[model samples]
Target: MEAIDGLIHGFGVAFQLQNFAACLAGVFIGNVVGVLPGLGVMTAISMLLPLTFAMPPVAAILMLAGIYYGAQYGGAICSILLNLPCHPPHAVTCLDGYPLTLKGKGGTALGVTMLASFLGASFGIVLMVFFAPYLVRIALNFGPAEISSLMLLGLLAGSTLARGSKLKGMSMTCLGLLLGTMGTDINTGLQRFTFGFPELDDGLEIVALALGLFGVAEFLKSVNAVAPVSTSATRIRIADLWPSRSELRTAIVPALRGTLVGSLCSMIPGTGPTIASFMAYGLEKRVSRRPQEFGHGAIQGVAAPEAATHAAVQGDFIPTMSLGIPGDAVMALLLGALVIQGITPGPQLITEHPDIFWGLIASFWIGNILLMVMNMPMIGLWVKLLSIPYRYLYPSALFFVCIGVYSVRSDMFSVGTTLAIGVFGHVLLRHGFHPAPILLGFVLGQRFEENLRRALLLARGDLSIFVTRPISLAFLLTAVLLLGAQLYFALRRRDEIQLPPSASPILDE
Candidate 1:
């Protein structure tokens, strides 16, 4: 009954004219940004965050949340039509989507993507509505030791699961933690890594770092890439938009499976949509009767990953809102936005600010509905956008990146910091180091340190308090188990590779 009443109140708040306008504008901008390469939700949000400083908290959050999820809807458009992914999660869609486009079934593939995305987002939102409150209740029982342990687990999971070498990921995470330690110490009044800069008192600006690492770094990469040339004229007619009954049937089960996978993965901090989408695609391929059809335009291939990506993104809000733990870098930015608005996110957020929490939830549904309605009709528009040359697009994006970072503090130092970070990020990219784990580490580092100190203080400087608390102990054990499993699999793979090839003994046997 309490949840029901809260939702009803949320509906009332979301239905307000100003909030509705904000939602519409946010989704519209998000969709447009998602259609364009070299610009993503993180960049868009970072650029627009300063503009939201004067708005009401609910209205500000509603808009930013819209952009975050609406981009998922838009990302699929380019992946299916142009073989170009606007976001990392959409990259999986390109494997099957482009092949389908080449087969002259682009319209069918896109239609399936739209349907799957809608269904996936709906499933995730429903899960969030039910599970977030329970999670918050459980989190309310947690003290500093448990919270610190949980954050450590999140960091370990992120580093271990990130693509490429775990060592590199761990290294990046450590770097991020080091960077996070800059500026004034929370417990003590002294500065740690300020390097004598007065601007470093508040710590490194998150807006500057985000714009540099993601926004500017992405722009630099795009600038060096060859502009795609469209030689053949691909016309998608309205008549070709509807999927055949058989195709629709083929996509249903995979979409459901993807939704389930995505919803579950989203609850885990540091796991994002890209992992969910890839996992969904891999699962579908493994279980299908014709695994060979995956890269060759399988409808299930298009449906599953697209669904999972959207669902995973929506599911991320669960941890971000309920436990004040961001699932990924994008969610970290959202968390920062909340703090900037003077609203703290945690277990008490719901009770203290029901309007913000419930209103944001209600707005998510509205934003998804708006995305579904906007996607199909605007297909032609988005497809047209793909034809525009990169040379034209990147410059405008770079301009925004510079201005956004500068506006954060009305200082040139932030812009210079963005440039430096962008160069460093480019170097990192060249060396196969992913920026996600680093960003997550930086975002959570402060909280982890704070809680660690608090826990020790509470326990009279005894480290055993972490092991003595049941919740903290459980989280640490889970982290150990996960790390052990990863190591075991890695060693097994190495052993398999080192083993000598079987000789003619098999033939003799």
Candidate 2:
């Protein structure tokens, strides 16, 4: 009864004239962004966050949240119809989905993909419905000691997720943390590393840092990077969106497995949909009877990754809401947006802002339904999006980054910082470094320091305070275990080697 009443209240809030319209607009924009390449949820949400100045905070957050998860339903449209992946999460879909198209089963692929995605998302929503609030209640009681320990775990997990040498990833993490602290001291009324520049007083604009690190760095990589000219995407048709009986059966187990894998993996900070989907697909392939069929248009292949994408997207929101730790870049941007709106997304969010919490959660399912209806009709549009020439697209992507970053700070310094970080990020990439973990570190580093200092202050400068607190001890133990596992795995693994993208798609081929 209580849940129903709360849900009714949510419906009352969400179904209002302007709020409903915002929901539709958000779903529409989400599909557009998800269908297009290079424009990630973070960039899209950050770019649009400024436009929310005149809108209600709830409505603005509702729309941005839609863009974040609606992509779970829409991104595969391009990956299946066009060989080009819409994003990293959908990259695995390109493996079997495109080949399924070649086999004249494009309709089956699209249908099953949509169904699997819906199921996975629904599973995550169920988890959110029952579990999220309890988690929130527990987290709401956390002290600075506990918060700091959580951040430590987050950084360690992020470092573990990076693809390069752990040391190099840690180096980048240190660099990001140092950069994160470049402006003002949060504790004292003093400036730490501003170099007497007023612009540095506000710290590095997150939009600039992320855009430079992920977006601009991506553009720089493409300057001379090989572009495969192919004509494989023009074969899309509406008939490709329906699933057959056998195909549906084939998708069931894989979808279920993928959902379980993705939802579980999502709880671990920094494990985004891309890695979750890939692991789910790998697990399915390893356990399948026809392992040989993998990367050769296997139906299970399409189901697992698609399902994982949805589950992971929903699951990633857990840490974001519970602990204020963004799971990935998109979540980071969402966190930033919430901060801008004067709505901190910590444990108190659910209790203090029931309307925002319940409304957003309810809207997720609405957005999922809206996603299917919105994306199915736009398959042709998304196919055309995939058909766009890289030459023209990248420049526009860069321009959007520039405009978005500049809009955040109203200064050219951000643009310059973006370019500099981008170039430096590119150079680091070439020298075998990854920025994703650095982003995680950068996002949590300040809070980690604050919490650590607070815990120390409370303990009267005793280092043993970490072990004195039960939650802190648990996190420390987990970190030690994680580091131990990483060492064991790294030692047992084969020599490091780079694999080409062409070969990458079919590593399990």
Candidate 3:
């Protein structure tokens, strides 16, 4: 009943003319960024952060949240029409989206993706409305021991579940954790890794790091790559936008499954849309009656991942809002924005700032509806954007990256830091390193260390508190189980590879 009252009040706030307009503007910009290759939600939000400094807190958050999910909708356009992903999560869409395009079903694919994204987002928002409060209530019982252990689980899950070698992911996570420790220590008032620089005491700017890793690195990579060219030109009519009855039937179940998977994954800190999308695709493949069709224009292939990614995007708000813990780097930025605006996110957020909490929730539904309505009509426009030359796009994006980083603190140091990190990020990418885990680690590192130290201090330097507390023990045990599972799968794969050729009946035959 209390939640219901708060939601109603939130709707009242979100319906205000100014807040509504902000929501519209955010989704509009987010959509544009999402349609452009190499521009991710993180980059878009990071670049836009400085602009939000002067806005009212609720309106600023509503707009930022609008951009976050709006990008999820826009990313599908490039993935379907150009065999390019505007964001990392959309990369999975290419498996079937481009194949559908090749088959002259691009319009249908786009329409289905839009619908799936809407359904997924709606489902996630519903879960958020109901589950977030409960999670917050539970979190209120947590001590420093539990918080520390929980953060460890998040970090471990992030590194272990990321695509590619777990070892490499862990290595990147360590790098991020180290980077995160480069500021002044809260307890001692002493700078740790500042190297005698005053600016360093405040810590490395997240905007600089995000722009460097995602924007600059992407710009460098895209500049050298061949621009994609459409092999055929076809004007899709409105009549062609709807999928066939059979295709719709085939996609329905997968979309639902994806929504469930993504919503659950979003609740787990450190897991983001990319992992959710891939997991959905993998599950769809496994359970599909005709798995062979997956890579060759299966309707479910496009539907499942699209739904999962969008759902995950919305679902991330659960942890971010309720526990004040960011599920990913983008959420970290959002949290930072809230903190900058003198708003603290946690269990009390709902009680103390009901308008902000409820209003933001209401805006999510509105923004998603706007996305659905706007995306369908704008499909042709997004497709047309592909014909624009890469050279033109890259320079404009680079300009924003530089300007955005510089604007963060009105300092040239951040600009230099972005450039340096961009070079370093590019090098890492060239060597098969993933940057996502690093960002996740950096975001959670400070909190993890603070809580760990606090817990130890409270326990008089006894580490057994972590094991004695049921909640802390549960999180730690979960982390161990996850790691053990990864090792088991890795060893099994290695064993299969090492088996003698003669031991295989197919080879012997």
Write down the lDDT of every candidate, Cα atoms only.
Answer: 0.86, 0.79, 0.85
lDDT winner between 1 and 2, please give it: 1
lDDT assessment of candidate 3: 0.85
Give me the overall lDDT of model 2.
0.79
Tens-place lDDT per residue, model 2, 1-509, is 55566667777888877777788888788877787666666557656666765588789878888888876666787787667686788889998998988888877898898889889998987777777777887887788888887887877777776555887767777877787787788888688788888888878777677777778776677656635335454565667678877778889999999999999988987778988999999899889999989888999999999898899898888888767987776777777777777888888887788888778777878888887776677676766665567788778878777877777768898789889988998888787887766666666777778888998999999988888889878988998898898888786553333545564433435
How well does candidate 1 score on lDDT at residue 89? 91
TM-score of each: 0.94, 0.91, 0.93
Candidate 1: 10-residue stretch with minimal lDDT: 500-509
Query: Model 3, stretches more than 4 Å misplaced?
Result: 226-228, 231-234, 244-246, 500-509
Q: How far is candidate 1 from the true structure (C-alpha RMSD, Å)?
A: 2.9
lDDT of 1 by residue, 303-414 (tens): 9998898899889999889888888888988988888888888898999999999998888888888887887677777778766888787888788788777777899999
Clash count list over all predictions: 0, 1, 0
TM-score, prediction 2: 0.91
* Superposed Cα deviation of residue 421, candidate 2 (Å): 2.4
Candidate RMSDs in Å, in order, are 2.9, 3.7, 2.6
Q: Where in model 2 is the C-alpha error above 4 Å?
A: 1-4, 223-233, 494-509
